[model samples]
Target: MLSAEEIHEIEAEAQHYPTREAVLIDALRIVQSHRGWVSDDALRDLAEFLHMTEADLDGVASFYNLIYRKPVGRHVIHLCDSISCWIEGYAGVRRALAARLGVDFGETTKDGRFTFLPIVCLGCCDRAPAMLVDGELHVHLTPDNIAGALEKYA
Candidate 1:
């Protein structure tokens, strides 16, 4: 069941849209903000609250990369893999992060501190080889500075 606070927030967001279904993405974000990730049960409850089908809600959730369906670590790392990032040495950064965190893309650290994932682009082509740690953009990254960049999160 959606909490009172969650419902209240969702309702407030719904007012900005023409229909409840239009608030689907915001609803998912609101729930995820409170719960960390959206589970099957939560999706079902949210769908019901929005008068939508589970399949519909799940489709939106799956299509959006930011909407985590499974449990994630305390911090999520999104590394850009666009052509610009690749040209700017994304491979080295990926290797450094994997070696440092001991987890590949789509995997979370054993201690559940970080989850690493690849994004198509962060839209900062000029500052390639960038990553977002818990939504904070870190641009102009190199293999050497990854440790320092990650240190501030924990």
Candidate 2:
């Protein structure tokens, strides 16, 4: 069930938009900020509040990469898979993370410390081979520095 606080926050955000649908993304974000990820129940409740169908809201959630449908670990690591990142040693970074965390993309660590996922880009081609750990971008990564970079989050 959506909390009265969650509903109130969503309604408050909706006030800035012309329509409820316009607030859909922010509504999902609001829920995610509080709950970590948007579950099926939360999605349905949010959809009903916004007068949108569950399927419709689910579509919106699935379309956005940042909106995690399943539960994620405490930290989410978004490895860039863009052309620049791939060119600039993305393989080593991927391997390092897979080895260090013992989890592949879309999987969470056994200790529930981190979740690995691939992102198309972080808009930092200049700083290629980059990744975001809990929304903090780390750039210019190499195999050698990758472990140290992750340590900050650990």
Candidate 3:
């Protein structure tokens, strides 16, 4: 499942650990890099590699939003529907994003290029209606701005 180069990199990183278990995070990252997300089979392989139980490794992956347990679209657009963003004007932003992506929240585009998810906050309360695209935050969102900015990604 891994190439010689990837195995070399993985082993190099694993070597730094006093215990192979210490490499769980790095292993998960490598797996994600190769597969774009962590599948059950991948996590099991990761568990075996780390000398840990699947549940143990899975707990860590599931706790972090950065790790994708399920298949996701190519681009993940997390729109902040937090109280602050809502008070400002998140509805319009949400609508714009949904329309631009041609999929509703928690859905992948038919072409599998984009997905929409709602986030509680981006910690940019001052910039309400803020949203994140591929982990990059954008502030002061409007329908026009959101639609215009998403053209290239679409």
Taking every candidate in turn, the Cα RMSD to the unseen true structure, in Å, is 0.9, 1.4, 2.4
RMSD of 2: 1.4
Candidate 1: list runs displaced more than 4 Å. none
List, residue by residue over 1-154, the lDDT tens digit for candidate 2.
Answer: 7888898998898899887799999999999988989999889889888888999999999999999999999899999999999999999889988998999999999988999999998899998989999899999998788788888675
lDDT of 1 by residue, 1-154 (tens): 9999999999998999887799999999999999999999999999899889999999999999899999999999999999999999999999999999999999999999999999989999999899999899999999999999999887
Q: Candidate 2: misplaced stretches above 4 Å?
A: none
From the highest lDDT down, the ranking of the candidates is: 1, 2, 3
Residue 130 CA displacement from its true place in model 2, Å: 0.6
Q: lDDT of each prediction vs. the true structure?
A: 0.95, 0.91, 0.81
Better of 1 and 2 by lDDT: 1
- Which of the two candidates, 1 or 3, achieves a greater TM-score against the reference? 1
Stretches of candidate 3 above 4 Å error?
A: 3-19
At residue 137, candidate 2 shows an lDDT of 92
* Candidate 1 to truth, TM: 0.96
| TM-scores for all predictions | 0.96, 0.93, 0.81
Report the number of backbone clashes for model 1. 0
- Looking at model 1, report the run of 10 residues with the lowest lDDT sum: 11-20
